[model samples]
Target chain A: MSDLKIIKLVKNFVGMDRPAVNNVNLKINSGELVAFLGPSGCGKTTILKMITGLFAPDNGDIVLDNKSLLPIPTEKRGVVMVFQNYLLFPYMNVNENVGFALKMKGIDKNVIEKKVREMLDLVKLPDIGFRRPKQLSGGQQQRVALARALIASPRLLLLDEPLSNLDAHLRDEMRDLIVTIQKELNVTTIFVTHDQEEAVLLADKIALIFDGELQNYTSPKNYYEQPKNIKAAKFFGGVNFIKSKKINNEFISDIGKINYVGENINDLNDEINITVRPENIKLSKTNDFDHNSFKGNIKSIIFSGTHTRYKIIINNLELECSLQSLGIKNINQGDEIFVHLPKDKIWGMND
Target chain B: MGGERLKIILSLTPPLLIIITLFFGGIFYGFLQSLGYQPAIGKYDINFSAYYNVMFSERYSKLFWTGLGLNLWVSFASTFLAAVFALFGALAIRKTFFAKTVCNFIYSLNLPMPHLVVAVGMIFVFSQSGLLARFASQLGLINSPGDFPVLVRDKYGFGIILAYIWKEAAFFFIILMSVLQSLGENFEELAQSLGANRWQRFRYVILPLVMPNLFSASIIVFAFSFGAYEVPALLGVIYPQMLPVMAFEFFLNPDLNARSEGMALSIIIALIVMILVVFYFWLTQAKIRKD
Candidate 1:
């Protein structure tokens, strides 16, 4: 049980003055699933590759369990990576491909077949042993690749944007498959992805990286309720930023003076960006907002299946509010409404 | 008709014209002339003496075996050397920048240097009074320069095969390198990630990807070697003559009847290449079925 520890990791590509991954320190205990999340080119994949030894770090060390892995070659490193393309061996069928790693380890044919069969069953691909990768569907091939990686029972499992290759619907299915498989096997896992929803669904802890720097590493609920800075706040996508001045660590925006929401309430300051999630936003026709409420006109109303997604223009600021249509009438576009932003749910960040 | 619609005969005409002019016309004229219907010889009547001479004459029969046997050896030997060289060149370039640049320069240089120039240079170095022969005599490997059976115009055909490898290996190198390079990064990387060592990656991923390109390149280079003329004449004119040499000998003969024999030999060489191409296609089909 090698617990992966990456200390002061850095990777600078040739001819580029800037490092893609700079001074990153992260560790995963045995059986812990840690996810790296950010927008594209935030160096999440570079970090994962370095961990897998596909790319070497310019500076720092990777310590596994009780030993330092400086002398161990990549082939000896008992760490397997599952790429987004699945990288299935084109010439080998499911059984042969899945048993390749075991064969390389000098495992007997009888043992390899037994282990491969168990892995196939684990990834729900037991019936695909005789089929080539091209013959299987995208989802089925992903399962085979998972079986191939999992059968080796690697000490560390690195997944680089694995769900990004699938369609939107199938991406959701792969997400559950990855988290469930990782938990059941209890492999020390590191999943790198740009999808915030994926990070939220699969990670026990999410590290938000921006410009090759770690901004926040915390639980999903904490990340939503307490983003450390403006960059981390903007990446989650549907948050409304209301610019305001903080007096005595409370933001006074179009909504009103609001205090801290969930976690990191101690990090509030004089100038802030108040983030109100669409789910917490309330809209009414009266100007009865007290601590953190504002007068806003609904500029647009779009139906998003379960709720009405409203684009509200409050004075000079814009806000996104969602109203679940549970026997409620349709909120027409360009309707003047008073938006009530909850003081407790507002993550006021000092940019 | 739509503007994009293909003209049916336009695509058909070039190959059809090529087959008629290069194959049919040459065969028809050669066949008639070989039967001894030569206006130049003041005999407009057909006779089977040229074919009979080819079948019965002791000297012509010896020349035929020497040329045909040497032709097969030169073809297969050069193909083997070129395959090994191309594989090494491709593998060397895959890991280093300067090695790749140097190899690119060498292979590209080989493409434009004509075979006759290469053969002439080889003769300059391998002849009896040549630098290599002189050095070998001084080193006591041979008693004299003349004692070194000159590779040029020898029964062994060493110089001819060298020239063939020089030109055709570069051609195979370029195609095989691209095939070896474009074998996507993920398969090899994923195999390593799956605990395969470097040799395992080569055996499982690299070799399988490049084998098809190797087979195709072999056939192409073999054709180029078989149809060759200048190098074979320059290097092996004394003994074990190649098919092209035999054709040229008959073509330049003083007897008008022997000129017809040259055309028949030319047609035979062409048929050999044609049969090999057909056989190559059939073998690859069988391999695919076995897979």
Candidate 2:
């Protein structure tokens, strides 16, 4: 079992003022696919590199299966990283590239060949083994890279923005392939990406990092429904924030009072900002909910292909709400509407 | 299309003219002379006598064969050693910015120096009565300058090989540095992640990635050292003289008839370089295809 734990990992670049990765901690169970999600230069890839033993953490331990991996060399760490550019060895054919790790292990040639063929089939590129990496398309190269990494059967698989190089369609295809392979092999995997959709779609747990610190590490749903701070909420597309103050357990805002229900508000400061996802704010023509309902006027409506987004004005506060296009037929600009801010869906953060 | 084609041809005409007339024209004239054609000396007949004399005749065969051996030995040894030294040097410094900058400056310092100057430098530094020998004598490590080991003008062409290595390793280093810089550490990192140790990473990834460039560079170095005259002429011994030095000696003969043999030797040197380059290309291409 390759359960991995990173405790207070820190890395400070020489010239930078702040640490590139600072005080980040995470625990990933065996066979659990986790994503280190953040924007560019947010230390997501730095964390991945540290885990792969490419970069040593300044002050922490990376434990895999109850053993500290700090002293192990990169090759002996049994951690494989697929680089962002899919850096396949240009001199080797696809089969040779896939079998390179096994060859390094002094495995038998026939056995390597058979395993390489099986890996090729696993990545769904069985017929292209003899072709060189340059001969393959971007998606095919990505598959070859994946096949090469997985063939090593690494204790931990690290992918650095593997799908960021692919087109839209290939991204979806590779996403499914990664999930399938990660589950099939039961390897503890951590992939770094700035794409939140990819993180939510692939990872069993998402570690949202911002500016070298772990903001929140939880299931993907928690990032949307219960973000740790306004920054974490904003990163996951939480935009409708209501500036408020918690007085006697009631969130008193400009619009109205919102009853607290989701998490304990004792830790939150009196001055707080509560936010709800645009899609979570229920918009209706009539007041249906007994609590946290506000009457508002629809200021604007944008009809996208799948969803229609509406900007509603309530008590001089403009709030954005998105509804499925199918159910948003009657909604139009300048129409009065009653929007319900569900107590359970509203996430509060101290300013 | 016709206008564009004419414009391209017009642009290329000058260099093409110089290449065809001066370069190939010189080679053709040399080839005709090597075949014993000498209109200047009141002889217009073309024959294979000069080639036969250089290759098989009793008068010149021993010198020709030994000269060829020395030429091969010096060229192969210098080129191989230079390439190996440059490869290691480049790998050592490729990861460091300051070291790379300083080394690049120091390494390219010799590239512009003429081979004759390098040969003279080798003699001054490595010869029996030179600076190193005098220093060794002063240190009491050697009894006298005469006790110093012979390097310059030695029978083994040590000084000649040394001069070439000193100059050519810079060339190899520059080529290798640019290649390794462009390659970065991505492939090596990928190999490392795939469980390849240091030696395995170098053997499987770094070496192959740089092979094509290194192969082409080695070809240029090999062909150059094989045919170059200055270092070998200044530092080579008498009996097993390099082919270029021996060919120059033949050309210096006042009897103009011996010029044909000189031309034959020069043509033989060119032919050998061409054949070897083509053979090397074929061997590498076949290996690449098989791989």
Task: Summarize candidate 1's per-residue lDDT along B17-85 as a digit string, tens digits.
Answer: 999999888778877787767788787877766665664578677877777889999989999898888
- Give a tens-digit lDDT track for model 2, residues A64-96: 999999999999999999999999888788989
lDDT for model 1: 0.81
Off by over 4 Å in 1: A244-246, A249-255, A286-290, A313-315, A329-337, B1-19, B28-67, B95-99, B126-128, B131-154, B256-268, B287-291
Local distance difference test values of all predictions, in order: 0.81, 0.92
Considering the two chains of model 1, state its CAPRI-style docking category.
Answer: medium
Q: Per-residue lDDT tens digits of candidate 1, residues A1-351?
A: 768787888889987668898888877789989889988988998887776778888898889996766567677888899888888887788999899899988999999999999989888877889887778989888888888888888999888888888898888887898889888989988888998988998899999998888888888877777777777777776468878786665556665556555465566566667787888887777767675556768788888788878898877777887788776554678877777877677776777
True contacts kept of each: 0.77, 0.88
Error of 2 at B266 (Å): 0.6
> Candidate 2: lDDT over CA atoms?
0.92
Number of clashing pairs per prediction, in order: 1, 0
Q: Quote each prediction's TM-score.
A: 0.86, 0.96
By DockQ thresholds, what CAPRI class is model 2? medium
The CA lDDT at B271 in model 1 is 80
